[model samples]
Target: AYPILAKHNIKPDYVLALERHDLVYQCFEQDNQEFDKDILFIIASVAHKSVIDTLEKTKKSYILVHRPLPFSKALHMDDYGYLGSGLSVANMAYDLAIKLGHKNIILIGQDLAYDENGNSHPKEYLHTQESENDRKEGLFITAYGGNGKVETNQWWILFKESLEYSIDTNSVTTYNATEGGARIEGSIEKPFKELCENLLRENKPLFEKPQTLSEKEIQDKKDKIDECLKRVVILGRSYINECEILKSDLARCLENLNFENQDFNPLSQRIYQMKAKFEDEEFKNYFLDLIRSIFFHFEYKIAQNYTKNPTNIEEEYAKRKEYIEIHINWIDFIIPHIKLQIQSIEKGLS
Candidate 1:
């Protein structure tokens, strides 16, 4: 506990744990509140059931925890799953810090375990392990690889992806003791730093720059979308056999809802075509609409909450505004993914 906390050199308002491991709790107990009482210590893990059962009698805010909701797994598996937990950490930290009126927060030891020798401990071992005994069983784990070099590439990939997904205008200076994972991945594995850096840099110049499309670029995008669409149309021919069965189920639902135009074929086909051969112009319009719609929904939700039942008036107002701001920033992160996917499809067509 001392080593872990000391290694980071900074204290978190909340210590989030997937499981109430004895060690984690011990650390929580030993550590003095360097931050404020507002910083919550949350414990969440699959094994939290046992802890909750045992400590049911005691009511203390110090040991606050939440279980992973099963339904949420469908949409947010990556955010809460084994590999996704790292991303969750960054997200939670950022949220907690922002709530506490912090602007610049440091991300501590997000380093990945190195693959020294041929054998090495995997970072995901915690999520994959079935029981406490299993995690404990791996104590004698050793590596077979010859070189004793540590590689954090895998951990870095997930960390960067998460940070990209969660980071906002707030300045987060990640203090990496070793080589920063983002730099290594961007430089070595792929020539993606130009794109990633442009998107992530805080100067705001990139955002303020004019978004004008060249004729050649538009034409190129059009040709690629055409080719991709043809492939999707072809694929739909193969799905015709199952269409009859699926339609029956779909029709029943539509009818029950008192829908008039019961036509899934055209809608499904259109969506397939759009996904396969997306028109840059059409996509630009559609994506903008989609994003704006999401933003509108978010704004309305926030506004409704603030206007209606007012709880934690100040905190709620701050959170509602902050979340809306995060949504806009998140749109920036999503743009690259959309562009890349479109580009990949275009290249495939070419």
Candidate 2:
């Protein structure tokens, strides 16, 4: 694929590679001969320390891309552009392309669904042992071209939805060059060869170097981050205190559990209201991703146990009390870490 791309002189301005994908390393190793010297590689951040170390050791000219999480936004916005919180790496790349002011973008190898051969990813990344039974049990969905069936899963369905949403909402003119996969709505389907031919004929600008922010812009962003950090710290402390109060109240309610006249509607409503505060976009944008996950997990557990009208009040109370204690302990465990993160951010900004 690289050799064919090089033969046609079809150089992309940048390649958005997710660090989680082994294909990123494979391309640099195997296709190094076909790579243009000017092509910039933008890699997404991975959680694994080994992968991070490997990426840092690479000699390739690249920038690490990060989602608009609190820390990344605070630090890397000036150097590396922020990719919005989209479900998949493909969606992140698309968002990054939009941010880079690319109006005419072509997507290649964005097969959101499995191929006809029952492979989840391309041949390069399929190192895992997959059984025929596993392949047979995979979900079937209509292919992007609407001709045949393609394999997909729930996560892929979510990714496809996210891709569709990104394309539909953005002003960019997107062309899908993938020959197979689930169809991404709002993108024009064209063969990769034909798209490249048209691009070569038109002498299109395939690459654009990202611009650095001005000093004033950088200072403004720092100021915004500082303000956000302060707000989040305050919110975190307040939430912990509130959770303590709720935990005590739940304990008292559990102590006086009445099976015949049991009514937890008010308690459930209160918990729902508390959970709704975390659902705010401002909170999501400002809080640390792990902290957000913790909060979300607590809310999910609470919803699962307490939200529904229970058939057996005493049995439900036992479960609810257990979860409530767990939630309280979890909050206690995380609040200090949240404070530490706030302090770190403050120190870094200073």
Candidate 3:
């Protein structure tokens, strides 16, 4: 795709590569394709270390876009950072485009669903063998050209939904120029050539100067980070205390063989309180991913048990005990990481 685009002298204003898509850079290098240096390469900050190393080795100019985490606020892009709510890099790229003030954005090669040949990504990119589970048909969505139905999995559906929401909620006009893949609602479908032809008359420069943070903004960001770190310390301590209390209650319940009458209300209330605190608007832009990561697994476990409807009383008792233990273990696992994060933030501040 890179070679074909290069052959046609098509130079995008920016190449929003997510994480391991550094493979795209390799393709360019191998082909000896020299693209416009001004083409901004926006990469996710949490990208794998290998991707970072590869980019550094290739000496490519790029900006690291950061996503909001539970312990940290979404950094301002003017400070060379970006925030995305979705997990996929495609969603992050879309966010970057909106942040760059692109009113009219055209998406190319964003095939959220597998192609007819069951190819998830372009051949040049790294290919992971699709598991039987992954290959299983789930939802059916209109193909890019509206020519046929394409099979999509849950994750791709999520990406499509996020993209659609972003498009609907933003003032930007989005167009799908991929000419293949799953259809993204709210984005008009247009051929690549036609979209280019329409834009050819525009005299505006393809790329804009990078937005940099003012001195005051930089100071404000630092203050925000410091405050966030302090809150994390408090939250971590509170969580540890709650976990200890829950563990004691669980132990007592097990001792008395009172599983049927056991009251989880107190534990539930504590967790609810924690969630409420975390969801505060002041912390909304912060490390939501971290909070979700710590809680989501446990929540899923509970949900899975409910779905299975455990019938045996003893089995139910064991499951409940296990759940409590898991929560305790998670708290133990997370506290050290939280302390470490706090330390890292403090060190950065100093």
Candidate 4:
């Protein structure tokens, strides 16, 4: 658009801008209309029940672009609008120009902020402002590359096509200004500049330095684990007390204990070992299997003997207490080794 306007040395009398929001279209209509006036109409989707009445009542036209599906997908167009390689807003503008039946359309203020005069938009503007009495309201050409290294080639594609078409004598004149977007490339642009004026900030500095912990940090972790162990031991006693309450019925008590012990033992041991094997991972799984088998056996025994031998409850309590003490000794021995493992980890980290 900028190239076309520059080729003919013509500044546009009317400009047509398209956005999806009707309210925004209305704002541009009312406010900017008093300034270097151009007709700005919102091409809203039929899906949005936007202020259609206001659009209709306004002096400018409010066109509805119909689509098969609802307009949910188009909401993210702002983020991905630069995806196309060559064809972008230029193609759209061309279509729009043809649709509006305008043979002599001219564009302005689209200068993408580049200069054929060996200057960037800022430098040129600063020089111009210093020398000229009155500042120009807008630029005339559309240029793409910014101060950043990561260049967007989409603008190049648009400029390529725009320049090629501007050579035609019968077509619209395109004028490109040096700068276009509100910010440099790769910078975050807030949706509404006025509303988010204070919210937007400069990009955060990247942290490239390595992060490492000190020897003291590693030792501190060991001390924390030691503190945790003491609390766990206190709670272990409470669990033992709860286990004692179910000891009155020998079969029921054994079944409950068997289920509890199965975590350290398993049913597969009952078939292969016929007894217990201790300490190894295989032994641990076997132990759980053995406990499950015992639980099953006790349940069967309880159902069979409960009616005839209900008074065997006293003997059952004694046997249960004996096994409880055995478990406590096992736990006391295992705790010291567990503490050693934690110490080893701390030493390794240090």
Candidate 5:
């Protein structure tokens, strides 16, 4: 949208982004579009560092906002308002529209479903080749007009659910102008041309520059940020140490274990203790979300391929060992990313 609209001298007043994935930075590289300085980028504070890096390299102006979804516990930017819902960028845009004092909104191109050709996303924001493959499994679901179905997927269903929830709660009138695709509840269905005829105006409306913090407030925020950054840095290092402890305990138990008598109670208790570390209060405050996601990914794989009846106790032991190793590897995977988050925070504030 940025590249095509810019070519015709059409520009958006604001753009919203809430993705935390590291790969999201690549979207800016597509088409090599020089984003306009006049455009305000409403970036989530928890977004990947690479994303903010690209924004800076392009010299685009932006304001960092935070979502209250575990964000209040992780970072301190509460003054910008919690502007995320439904865990989708569309929801974030809706929230921003309401925050900016808009009482009416018209949705368009909000398909939330694959086209008849099986493409699940626009070319502008395709995250990866793997995602493209994941989106095309030849699926279908009920369409907008309720007379037929359209090709869709699990994610598209989820996106619609989020938007519907947002609309159901907000005190505003919504006109759904998407000519085709999934149905969003709580929205008044209308044709795009009909809605435009009633809503479109000949003159443009002026927008006020949003108020920002004063100099004293800015200094206070910086001081608070510096303090929080140092604390998170110190706390994040403990995860590595905890992983080492888990690895050592598992190694000692595995070496002397006896699988001869079909007795695995001792090992089971050890595994229970190993899982407890991941549930600690302090750790959950920072890295538990990442840890749990990786853990579940491994668990899901194990369950997907599990046999109803294993040949022997050795196979069960193997599964147990695999489970423990997943936790160890998950910790290893998240620590560096934690540092990357801190770097992102520093750069975002700078």
Candidate 6:
């Protein structure tokens, strides 16, 4: 989009990015290489390190921003640019628009549906290149004019829903000027040309580019990030040790195989102890996404409340063993995963 805008001699003042993965870097590497270097790229601070390195190497104008959760809770907004919203960079752009005091928001190219070629994103994005596969797995939604259905994947469906929620909650009015594609429920679907004819006149510098932060501001943010990452490392190590203790306690209880007998109190107490350890407000706030991701992979069926009306002691014992083993396996997995996370964050600090 930046390169295309540049091609037409229209460079947007800013290009916001919310992706924390390397794909954002891959996008710049694959295509869009001719992007306007002057366009400020407001990136999430948690974004892959390679992205920051690549932007620096290419001399692209960029700045890192906090992603709301940990930063909004722990750090001052003045430390880093506040980049909220998780769904899409476009939504973050909305926050920026509001900050700029724009009461009217005009959205363009928010198709939220596949193009004629069946691609959800630009052709240059390799991640969405397999349009046929996407079409096979995707669902259809009502199109803009309500006369047809447009094919869209789950992710775009989510983005559309998020935008509708934002529009409903925000004080500003949203004009969806895309002219086609999946309908945004709360936006006024006016044609771009029609809106331009009515609302736009030959403008005489309606807005000014926001000022860049001074060296002292950037240095302050760096110091804050360094402090937080060190604390995360300490918390992560403690969490890993706690999980190991729980696993060991569970193992001892499982050796006897009966929830009603032998070492039961010890195992239950260990699990209860973990609840308090993890419930630390600072740790939970800092690693909410990490906790959510781990839980998402939890095997809920097996760990479900005990077998209903077990026929005998043996049957109940077997069920209890299965449950304990599942938890131990989960602990075994996360201990190493947490270590890796610590290592990764540590590298970034370095």
Which candidate should be chosen as best, given lDDT against the real structure?
6
Identify the candidate with maximal TM-score: 6
By TM-score, the better pick of 2 and 5 is: 5
The sequence of per-residue lDDT tens digits that candidate 5 reaches over residues 1-350 is 44445656777877778889997676554332444756887888778989899888777777777776653555556655687765778888888888877777888778877766666555543452235547655677778877688877777778888888878888998888997888778888899899878887656577778787799988988788678766665666565555566666656555665443334455446546645755666566656654567667766755644543557777766766554455455546665666676575557556
Q: For residue 269, what is the lDDT in candidate 2? A: 68
State in Å the error of residue 206, model 5.
4.2
Question: Please, what are the lDDT tens digits per residue for candidate 4 over residues 1-350?
Answer: 32233334544433333334444333322322233224334243432334455445444433444221212122222321221112334434544555455543333233333334423333324234233222333333323433432222345435545535543433443323223431222222223343235433555344243455588975775566454444333433443333332222323434565433342233223312322323334333212322444445544544444344324655555444444444443334433443454454345445
Residue pairs in steric clash, candidate 6?
none
Q: What is the C-alpha RMSD of each candidate to the true structure, in Å?
A: 23.8, 5.9, 5.3, 29.5, 5.0, 3.3
- Greater-TM-score candidate between 1 and 6: 6
Lowest lDDT block of 10, candidate 2:
124-133
lDDT of 1 by residue, 26-45 (tens): 33333333442344445554
The deviation in Å at residue 276 for candidate 6 is 3.1
Model 4, C-alpha of 337: deviation from truth (Å): 56
Q: Candidates' lDDT values, in order?
A: 0.40, 0.66, 0.65, 0.37, 0.68, 0.73
Quote each prediction's TM-score: 0.31, 0.65, 0.69, 0.24, 0.75, 0.85
Q: Write the per-residue lDDT of candidate 3 for residues 1-350, one digit (tens) a residue.
A: 44456556777655555544445444334322366455555666666556556556656566776666533333433444446667676787788778768889888777888767775665444343242235546678888877789877878888888989999999989999988888888999999899999975767655556688899987987787676666655655665566566566656755665645336556546556755665676444444444557667776776775565567987777666666566566566555655665566567667
**Model 6: runs farther than 4 Å from truth?**
29-38, 75-81, 122-138, 202-225, 256-260, 306-308
**Of the candidates numbered 5 and 6, which has the greater TM-score value?**
6
lDDT of 2 by residue, 2-50 (tens): 3345545777666555546544454444344335567666666643344
Where is the poorest 10-residue window by lDDT in model 3? 124-133
Candidate 1: stretches off by over 4 Å: 1-12, 18-39, 44-48, 54-86, 113-156, 168-174, 177-350
